[model samples]
Target: MRQNPERRTALLDAAIEVLAREGSRGLTLRAVDAEAGVPTGTASNYFRNREQLLVQILHRTRERLVPDEATLTGPFDTAALLRDLVARMRRERSVHIAMLELRLEGTRRPELQAELAAFHGAELSENIRWHQDAGLPGDRHEIVLLYLAMLGLIVDDLTTPAVLEPYSVDGLIDAMVARLLPEQPVN
Candidate 1:
């Protein structure tokens, strides 16, 4: 396996693009190498097998989609946080699409399913902890509700944006926050 961090990251990023564009069935090492404009065997050097590649893609997707530190610097404005999150997701549409593809693939592959379930479980715990640390006015249940609602909104926005055209995305986010965290006044 290669030891170049930059090359490995590049390969994983290329894999993300391939996954988004080709789905799991089409995510071959050659596809990633071509996507990265690298030599034919470069991805194989970085990842031993497709499962390893898929798992690494999950980590890369999370890294790519994390909230910006600047957005986390102020008071716990749920609407603002959600708005920033949604904007990031929209901007990194490929990352989200790749992630969705992995999720669908997970349904058919038990190992991938376990990996995704573990990743999501940890992420959920982190979100809850972050919300508490930020003094956000919501419990775990509310947080989970907001998470589900936002996930649905994001899926719609990314895959079928026209479905949400009648209402402004920001407005919808605001409404979702207001409804979910009734205690926190919507911004």
Candidate 2:
């Protein structure tokens, strides 16, 4: 029998919830089935093994988190992008935490590390394309460095936003943009 697409998505979401709630160790097929309120063997029917399940989760995360072209082309300023990113991060907090769990889990698992690197590389390529489409002023390397710096900001703000409470999100975004973004000279 063919698997239901909705059922597969539900299982993936359940897996993400399990990872967020109980960390990576709890991401077993049994756990996913339990979270989805399905039979014990359902997860196994969909994903061949743990690595396969993780790969699905990563793909689903990118589907939800990757913005469409309109958002990319609408307004290309750093502050606007940061504001949008902060909102998205907050909205997808569970997914973000689950991603962190997966990354830490990847440290001991070579299979996961390779899979994640490939996904990350693709994501970086899309980001570079988005920047070019938006007419952002930076080469790929500079954009990559800016991307890492933004990740630091996102992670810090997610973990202990109080550390940056004095600056306010907008102000901090302005400071980050000022430091990292290339300035254009007046014509």
Candidate 3:
């Protein structure tokens, strides 16, 4: 099969749209083809199977969630970063829903579980690198805790929308920053 990046991206976008609008249960090759304005055979030709298509969508989602290396810098403004993270999460609602579905699907599919784990591991690595660059003082255990806390925020925001009102991401970031970097009193 010819490698047409544009067509592939279009198909992936279509898949995400379908999943977002109709949920994972409604996702099908024909649906994606119609959404992408491509023929059903073309969609099938690109993704040999439904599983492969779903995996591709997940991969694309991972790419969006993980910040670029260039964006990871030292002494990051925690509040600003938190706001950006929140925005990114909100923008990727479809991906989040798809991830939840993927987790359930992983129960019977070991390969899916492995893929999810690998993606999570990569996310952790990126977080660790960002923390190191930010001059944060902590061992791997501490950094892991921070990362877990961030994940908790994401999950909470998604599952319980009410949490966002009382404790905004910016507020959480402020609290975390205070704990991570105590202020030095002026002389």
Index of the highest-lDDT prediction: 1
Residue runs of model 2 more than 4 Å from their true location after superposition: 68-70
lDDT of each: 0.92, 0.83, 0.75
| Reference-based lDDT, residue 148, model 2 | 89
User: How do the residues 62-158 of candidate 2 rate in per-residue lDDT, one tens digit apiece?
Assistant: 7778765766776578678878888898898878878888888888899898988998898889888878777776777777877888888788887
Location of the lowest summed lDDT over 10 successive residues in candidate 3: 177-186
Instruction: List residue ranges in candidate 3 displaced over 4 A.
Output: 66-75, 180-187
**Between 1 and 2, whose TM-score is larger?**
1
Q: Tell me each candidate's TM-score.
A: 0.96, 0.91, 0.81
Please give the RMSD to the true structure for each candidate, in Å.
Answer: 2.4, 1.9, 3.4
Candidate 2 vs candidate 3: the lDDT winner is 2
Judge candidate 3 against the unseen true structure and give its global Cα lDDT, from 0 to 1.
Answer: 0.75
TM-score of 2: 0.91
Q: By lDDT, is 1 or 3 better?
A: 1
Name the weakest run of 10 consecutive residues (lDDT summed) in model 2.
67-76
The full ranking of all candidates by TM-score, starting with the best, is 1, 2, 3
Cα error, candidate 3, residue 177 (Å): 3.9
Error of 2 at 49 (Å): 1.3
Cα-based lDDT at residue 159, candidate 3: 76
